[model samples]
Target: MSSARWIYLDAGRGLAALVVVHHHLMVFFDHEMAALIGDESLLLRAFRGISEWNVTAILFFFFISGWSIFLAVERLGTLNGIGPWRLYLLQRARRILPMFLLSLLWAGGLSWAGERNFNDTSFDVLVGNLLFLDTPASLRGLWFPPFAGNGPLWTLSNEAWYYISLPVFYWAVYSKIANPLVRIDAALLGSFVVGIAAIGVNAILPNPFFLFATLWPLWIAGYVYGTSFGQTPIERRVIFWLGLMALVTWSMALEIRSDTLRILSDGCILALCVVLLVKIVRWQTQLTRLHYIDGIVRLFGSVGRGSYTIYVLHYPLLLFLASSRTELGGLATSLLGMGMLIAIAPHLETRIYAHVNQWFALDRPRADA
Candidate 1:
């Protein structure tokens, strides 16, 4: 791995992955939570507000993935020794496919035990998911009768689809477009413009899920913005403040079913992407008394080494917990549960990948320096 590249992208992925965990925590933990928040208590109101806007976290993943992939290609291309494509694909297969398949079985089993009628009607959709074709339709139901019942899988499918298609997309922008800088500029400008247009169109058609399709352009925007605009000191600070402002503004705004607000929210997410990208480039993290927090981040990053497993396996575990309803000792219980999953997931994920590689005969590739 390129040490410089690894430093930021790994750290960014670490943040994005944690956001995913936090987003899910809000979902699973929020039960009669609105009532618990006393009318006058600002703290409880803030907590409720964060949980309601949890979807934004997944969008962060999409943007980061785009930026990271572009940089990976750029660096590897410059180095001239690494087989970027091979390395990328091997890692992708190891990280994504095994866990995805395992989750299918796990979810299927849970469905059986719970006596929840698993509709196999959308066999085509299942196949689509199996191949990541479902990504473009990520917000839609997985199976006709909502067989899997895991909303997160859609993003995974979207992620897989992005990985599968990125080579062609990268080549188009980086090679076929003739001027890399120009293409990057267009991608950056076009994503927000098109995103707003999409929102307008969706308002007429009412595709709440149509926004999932924006993942592609949002990602490409990050890629373009990173490649074309180097992280200058002033730019970094500006982007950080802009991102923070957007987050704060969005948090303060009341919910209104207006396309304008949706567009603004998307823009805010774009800004946040810029901030995170700049932060990684700066690498100015101070080691405070948050050693435990640091350790948790480090642990999650390691488990994120095989996050595909955790992502895939986690829903079933959560479903079981939800279904069983065995008394978890409140907020502490939720944290502990997530902690245990983080601890075990990495090891099990690696083992599962080993078997997957063997089964697929994927271990024979010689790493050509």
Candidate 2:
């Protein structure tokens, strides 16, 4: 990765994480939320109008994930052998599991200490959380919200599964199939068809069990984004924009009569938004002369480097802060959580995730230089 080219990406990741933080932090402030309800400022009104409907932050994350997997493909040159796939899975696990276990232990311990209910969580639920198998939507049907102490981590299950399945995807979509057009065609067709099947299953079954089926399109789109990243072409982005608009228009055309269709349409829009976001930002940074904007991006990018840890650990931290009722109150405590994350990320990343990721890297010889 060219540092200049990817600064926006890191900055974007950081910004997406910040947005989620800000949204959750606002949950602590009754007055602030009430003010939004009564807000008259046009700018704030517009911000709320978009922000309220924008579930695109997490969607962008998945896009970035796909892109990341693509980079692995480019450098590693596909998982043609079992040994490469084993290293790939090991690297992913080591990168995620250590810190994940730390957070889970902390949260689980706190829950038991506070409630004196060590028996509250069952093996399946705990296993599901540890493995990223259970989602809030899925657990909600079973009346198991409390077990999902860190709700955001639920997406990790999707990511984990995606990571595991990526080699197969690499082989089927990009590797074993030599024809590029055929690969894209197969991916698009298979992903959408499976996604439709998932929607049907989702209609009848509890969510997240078939979550991958529902979100295959978005992940594939992310893969496309990664493969296409930094290729300076206007038409690719233009096509993505058109596809996004078409999905939005189609959703509106139907007026959201069926909930399943509504979600599928939303997923399509979100997937495109992910691609458009990276594309537009990269384009902007390239065209702009503003040094200050670059500096700001660098700052956010710095904070964003630890965004995953922040995202995973924030829920528990927020809960602790709120329950402690520090003189700082909710908003300040929430902000404090951000500060703690920024401070902690460098250490955790250097000592943990980055090292593992680097060690597991497939194209290390080329990357090291």
Question: What's the lDDT for all of these models?
Answer: 0.55, 0.61
Q: Write the per-residue lDDT of candidate 2 for residues 211-316, one digit (tens) a residue.
A: 5556666776667666556555633753444385446536553964544456557667766665566567667867887688778898888867777776777766
Location of the lowest summed lDDT over 10 successive residues in candidate 1: 137-146
* Candidate 1 lDDT by residue in tens digits, 1-369: 334444444445555555567667667666534445565578666766665544565566666666566655554454222377777666666656656677777777876675344434256756656755443233322222223665567666656656666676665455556655456444444554555555556556643234444445556655554564444553444454445545643663355555344535665666566666455634544433435645655654675554555556666656655555546544455566667877777577667657767886655211100
All candidates: TM-score: 0.68, 0.80
Residue 192 of model 2 has an lDDT of 67
Cα lDDT of candidate 1 equals 0.55
Q: After TM-score superposition, what is the CA distance of residue 50 in candidate 1 from its true location, in Å? A: 4.1
